[model samples]
Target chain A: MSSNSKDKDNRRRRRSSSLMYQEPPESLEQQSDQAVLPNLNAQWVNAKGAWLIHIIIILLLKIVYDIVPSVTQETSWTLVNITYMFGSYLMFHWVRGIPFEFNAGAYDNLNMWEQIDNEDQYTPAKKFLLAVPICLFLVSTHYTHYDLAYFMINFLATLAVVVPKLPALHRMRLAFLNPEPQPTDQ
Target chain B: MNSSNIGTELPPTAVAFIESAAASFQKIPGSAIVIRYIRSSYQNDPIRSLVELFLFIFAVRYLLAPAYSTKKTKNVHLTEDEIDELVEDWTPEPLAGEQSEWEKLENDRIPVIIGPAAPKTKLQNGRTVTNLASYNHYNFASNPELTAKAVNTVRTYGVGPCSPPGFYGTQDVHMKSEADIAAHLGMPACIIYAQSFSTISSVIPAFSKRGDIIVADKAVNYPIRKGLQISRSTVRWYDHNDMEDLERVLAKVVKEGQGKPLTRRFIVTEGLFENTGDVVNLPKLVELKFKYKFRLILDETWSYGTMGRTGKGVTEHQHVDPNNVDMIIGGLAGCMSSGGGFCASTEEIVEHQRLSAAAYTFSAALPALLATTASETVTILQEEPSIIQNLRENIRAMRAQLDPRSDWVICTSSPENPVMLLVLKEQVVKDRGFSRQEQEFLLQDCVDECLANGVLITRLKSMPPALGSSPRDQEKEWLPRPALKVCVTTGLSKKETEKAGIVIRHAITAVMKGKKWQR
Candidate 1:
């Protein structure tokens, strides 16, 4: 009995060492669930007035910032550009999953950036989104009259958002900034 | 067309205004840069400039378009008089179509029980007849012990819950009942819904969303069919109780889904079929579920508290572990003679249903009295194994009287099923060449004849044509064979049950021999 038990243990060890470990079944199940339904997170970007809404938000931010006493056009423009960039980044890249629960956690592992167009690298929507920040930077720089301080700040804000959207960084998680989804109790 | 000629032809005020506009445009900042940019971009090509102008106009038109359009095609232009004439010519369909002749007859023939449903029930016609139509297989609805318990519960908790279970409607009794059922079925936990008919319907959509695959038996009861419709899940049907056909369908689904993402695949079936009154092969079903890695949602509404040795349901009867089944939906109103339904499964599944299942979360909790009665009945089933045996024995006696002895009809139910379903024999049907509607009419005649002979039974109730669906649409659906339902009960003595069974057999014979039914 002891020799048989040892033989069984050795076989188990050999099998474990021979094969490369694959992801847990849960991840595959989640992937299938994601495939079953179209991701709502990405589809909303294509909706009517979706592009217009971004322009409206930037305008609103400019107006609101301008209402503050003694604010200059340069300051207000830079603030609008920064605010829009931050909001877009939070909405598109930082959040990992949809706001709605109807899809059954299919998008839990993916952010809106990776979910758009089923993770295709460069669609029209993505291209339009990438152009928005760059245009805003140029607009802010022009309004600021190319002041070194404001131009640098606007450039940095644009870079912060545009860099993460590159296809190479798709589904890549930063260790300190964006950790993997913790296993839910369910 | 020359500038000098145009200037000379224009009025003095117009010419002066044009000159001022040009002067102001030239005065604007970065006007030279704008001209340079356009010149470089279009490269002085008139076609490119025209194209750009057209694109600009198109973008403006698109942006200005209305958000929602009702009609895809262009609207027809009609004169006012023509529109009035068309409006006058149109007629609206009726809200509900007139009931068919069969439906009217059925409505008129519904027997009104004046008192409690029992083995012997007094109908409005002032006749006490043997009642074999109710889901009171053990006749526990009128049991003194259960009645006392129900009364005690009512006194303590009142009649109405007044809230949904997710709210304050979940009383201590409800928890006790859930625990009792979970323990009785040897499952981890159980959740109870207010009504049995809507229980499975709600539980189905809770887990199985769109794109999820469901493999169901063709002969599942009406409630299950409704559940499948409401779930909107992809459904595949196999021949009823045919394991080979089920495996074939499962394998096909798996193959079709190959390399695609794994969906939540389910095998939805009943332990004892309510439509056909036959038992499912549970062991083989469990094997198939494991083999395919598909979860099993077993509706044990008819078999629970009727089939097992101590009435723990199909799992006990087949000696399969209850844990192997993903979800077990059972009716408390059926053989248990209480009200509501319970879904027993693992803790996680039950917890999920608490907030997800519509009938449980939206509807008021089951009344406290019914919960107490359900708890007590489950306990009685556990303590006294003979109640089930008594029911089985009565079933046997009923079978002996009707199944082998009847020449016109044959029992389609398994021997263990207390609800004995009698369908016209194949030879009888072939000889008469009866269609589905004719068979239903013949079964109704048998039920009426049995009632006149002081035996109360019912015909199998087929679902009404689904709302807004034509009879032609219903033709594609699988309809259970029209049959007479005779529910065996322990309330009656073996001799009495056998006598009623004989009366039923004679009733079928008499109906078949009647000149009105002759082919």
Candidate 2:
């Protein structure tokens, strides 16, 4: 017992002398919380506002599409398709967040919102559930007259906000991706 | 306000001009004359005849456009990249050593020190700090009678009762104050504790225990949250002020309990939420309590001496019977103008708290002086019932002076509430491109301006900003800072109450207009 105690004391002395610091592990919530912009919770500064601005732009285009009448035909379909694609790219690339619930035909991803900020990794199948809302919305535009393309454009634009959240989806880190995981000591 | 008073201070000439203008303005209208035509049309027909009379709406809407648009009111709209820039600009310096700032505070005096609750507390330099953003509502702190009682009791009892309530600490004064509270609450018995925060913190754990479940508001005060923590029970937080959400949560609790033979459930809420300055819907809360068959523990920490016919609290204010609530928890530290807290319930529940409440069994008793102070203040409430009206009137005047839907300012609290919180609209904060610190600093500057101009206001402290926030999205880092809290007392005059709104508004606009954020 005496020998063991001395050994323990010597080990402590050496460890203390080394002066090496061991940082605490950050919680999944903390890690995910720092991974993106915090302002997404509020207005204007977060992905919500960016999404809103894109949505507004699409709405304004809908007014033009309605007024011009030329864009509604199959010929202007290319124009609408191009606009929707670009809108989707801008939204998914620029915005950094998504709404709590993105509703589909008979399904809702409401419960997934709380888990989004957790470091609990998700798959493409789970992340693909986010695209359902736009698919459903675009279908509605086909039956309606108010430039259904706007809804598709608006929905696709906000996709960038949620895509980075899933680890498997985001790429090209140098292009503007937040760090994967920092040391988190601070 | 009438068209009759428009021309030559009489309607006859005005009516003639309006009739003639209405008949001819249509022919005179061209491209640039649209507004003139509308005006001429409005003046000619006065009431726009019978059919198109409301065409004047265009003119009014056009005039009100600047005041109504959120975009027009806001000055800053940072792009996503700009937001990332600000968030990354100046990160909080992380400490080098192992000890955190909170741990260091335990060993050292706070950079800012607080005096005992008073009308005008002395600051570090012995300067009078009237309202450097204090929302303490401790009106009786510096009262001559209360202060004298404290002095006399300090000389006699020597500050502390020196024993727990279970021991020799139950003095005559303690019994008297408890009795006074019981009488005031219209309950069978009341138990007092060493401090106000501990009352709820101890009661929840003592009553609910580990296996029980507690349904609470998401925005309850910290003490209540701490109590919920101590209970170690499954806590379900309903959206703040949303009865529907509460019902949904309670229904789920009932469903969960259906499978269990014996389960304890409790609903906790505050009579007046301190953070939001809004009163809870007591009638709806009581209805839910019966519908769910869960016991209710209502914390009246802020509402106790500020509501009801004679400050009997939300029970009387909302006409809910005291018997409906299973337990009433209150803190005397604020508004009641004393230290310590009390739990009022039936004899059995009160006995359970006295026997098992950790704060009561382990903590020193409340000083005899504070017990007397509380009893004395209750008497003051009885003697002067009009003081409640005075406070209500001051709040009403303050609200009346500011447009409720103005884009410039937003009030989180209702007009009737004595504790009013006014914040710049979120859009306004975004427009100014003010960071969280910049916003707080600007609010402080506004308060200082108000103080210099002889009116004092306070900006509430927001939750500490999260460390390691995203530097990439600068706008995403802009936290919605807490609103300024301005509390009214019976001592406040009607004129000052009216002036308070103008003072606050002017101070905010002046501060916003004077300087620009560096980065």
Worst 10 residues of 2 chain B by lDDT: B63-72
Deviation from native of the Cα of residue B332 in model 2, angstroms: 0.8
Tell me how far the alpha carbon of residue A54 in candidate 2 is from the true structure, in angstroms, after superposition.
79
C-alpha positional error of residue B400 in candidate 1 after TM-score superposition, expressed in Å: 0.2
* Regions of model 2 farther than 4 Å from truth: A1-186, B1-138, B402-407, B430-438, B452-454, B462-481, B517-519
What level of docking quality does candidate 2 show? incorrect
- TM-score, model 2 to reference: 0.55
TM-score: which candidate is best? 1
User: Which stretches of candidate 1 lie above 4 Å from their native place?
Assistant: A1-99, A102-131, A137-186, B1-93
TM-score of chain B of each: 0.87, 0.71
lDDT tens digits by residue: candidate 2, A19-106: 3322223333434333444323322322345445545654565455657755554324334445654554444443333443111100
User: Model 2 chain A: which ten-residue window has the lowest total lDDT?
Assistant: A101-110
* Shift of residue B86 alpha carbon in model 2, Å: 41
lDDT tens per residue, model 2, B21-98: 777865674734665444543433332222232222422333343321111235698999999999999778657646
Candidate maximizing lDDT: 1
Error of 2 at B66 (Å): 86
